[model samples]
Target: MHFDTRLFIFIIINIINVRPNFGQYSDDQSYLSSIEFNRGGSLTNLIFSSPHGGFLGANLTLKKLGKSLNNETLTTILWQLPVAGCYNDSLKQCVYTLKDCLQSNNKILSYHPDARCVIDRSSTLSMYLLTKAIAQSFVSHYHPYTILNKLTRQYVDPAEDLPRGTFLLESAIRAYIDYHRLIAIAKEAIRSPSRGLFIEFVFHRNSQTIQLGYGFDPLYPSTMGKPSESTMHELISRSGPSVIIGNNSLGYFLRLNGFEYVIPMEQSQQQRQIRYRLSTYSTRMHADQRFNAILFSYPIERLRKHSIDQEAKRIAKAIEQFIQTNNIKILSSFASSLLSVNRIMRLCVLFLSQSFTMLYISH
Candidate 1:
């Protein structure tokens, strides 16, 4: 099948409708003026993110929440749970570290006080930008600070005290709302005759491996296109063992990338079933078995582990290789093609429009 212009148009319109409103305010003298979500090109399912690569604006938000490196106030601390990191409190903060938990001093033991690590996910934003610029493809960034700010409400009111389970409940609600927004986009894209694969990008501070996530047991409907096991295995093989490594790329990427992973409450067998049950709401929907959500998580300390530019190039190349190797089809020709001149005109129009969208969206 040839390129499906209709499908492409549908994708573009959806993105434009949801495009973050960063215009008019562009001349404003704040980094907040430039911050946007759902930024990237359209017509592809490939998505990338630097969830933790948002330190600049994040610090601003922290300061607004009364965080100060000098005096001890109700500081907003970026901390990782003991289960989330491979580092001890004694170790210097490394690149692979992701401070997922957001807590306030008012909340007793809401998060580990000593495990705070203020480093951004290093060069993840730059890495993602490089891939998008070169590939001319779509990517997304989940501003960790924005998400966490909404979760902890520290920026809104640093002194606002929350009960033990209140913060967690609010976080889960906010997460689901954002996640469903993405899922809606995917569902619309999938409705196109040329269904594309939905990809999520992430960073893992403790490892320098790319983890892949796709497929599901027969119980659920797939949300993205279904990529076979052989496709995943082959893509992994081509990426080389050194390029692919991580414990939970799918889970982490989903949480950060706006596709929060969900499991059926009835099937959960954990000890804290009530707590888990409270967290498991309709918004925390898992990727159905049909939708193929492939996750790519790079090492956090990638700048020090290796050259940042090289790492970006390697990952970008691997992604293209995976798409082509899997023979993933995303478009189809319509009945009775137009004349050569007409086709050329259509191509030119599409490119011009796409370029314009990318120009504003990528900022």
Candidate 2:
């Protein structure tokens, strides 16, 4: 059998030269269908993430870390675990999968019942709907990249440190890595000389007010200080502190849109006692680079089914106004088109490479 050495080399070269298609959307089913990535049109430098909002459960049994707590206390302490199914009898343990519970005629309750399976409740139907709404709001003019984790937080918590997040589980580790990899790809898609913004959503039932975090100390003074000390230093250096807390700030816009309570108001107290700071493992790691990060924590009330659209629109508008006021340059249509072309070229190269390899093997 004769092998075409020249053709084989050429195919290998093409495969090596092809860059990853960062501009293309990714629904990576290979990693147990844990992550969903929505590629931006490259029109905007904004990236949104939901680390805790996930629902799908895995086969791995839930591990009880540290002291033992009852089902109600455990669910309450871990805000992400949603109620899957409930058992009426105290002697009977709840089942692992929602389907199993449903088949057994178990009741589905949010709290105060023995749950057989508990997934991340944070990604409730309303939150998912809100993400869609925000995506649509930016579709016409400025599109922002979005990354969501689909697996239940019970198995993997991508926002936490690897040890705590994955609990050394092989499957959980893979999902965690994929989650960050998707975010990194999204960032690459929007790579620019100017800094970008990363907004991560976390739902909290404790506070009615919307809290925007920039990695500052919860009690840090609201006044502008050393930019180098905060995670948003790059953004602060470019646009100054006013872009974050002035009349044209995102908080200001949220107020204009009828959100009554927002942290870091124009006339905030000398000591800002924020409850939730964007200091999560993932947020800190990402914010240390070319993107400014904000941990957006809002009351779960905002995610109510009836008002999610309105809530999302209001938040989207606030982000838009913030970008405009800060002079953050969005990618031009021409640049976005170039990215799309890059994706197509990469796909073609990969296809050709695979076909040639198969043909050579057959010989």
Top model number, lDDT: 2
* C-alpha TM-score for every candidate: 0.38, 0.66
Candidate 2 Cα deviation (angstroms), residue 290: 2.7
lDDT of 1: 0.34
lDDT of each: 0.34, 0.64
**Which regions in candidate 2 have their CA more than 4 angstroms from the true location?**
1-29, 54-123, 267-274, 333-363
Model 2, CA-based lDDT:
0.64
1-363 per-residue lDDT for model 1 (tens digits): 234578678755654444221211122332221222343233343433222232211221111334323344443332323222223445554222113233345443234323343333223354345333334321323111111112222211111112211222343333333433444543443333433344444344444334343322211224212323322333333342221222222333223332223222112344123221111111113233333344444444545745555555554544555455454443333311222234456666876777677666766
Deviation (Å) of 85 in candidate 1: 12
Candidate 1 displacement at residue 236 in angstroms: 13
In Å, residue 291's CA in model 1 sits off its true spot by 2.4
Task: Evaluate residue 135 in candidate 1 and report its C-alpha lDDT on the 0 to 100 scale.
Answer: 41
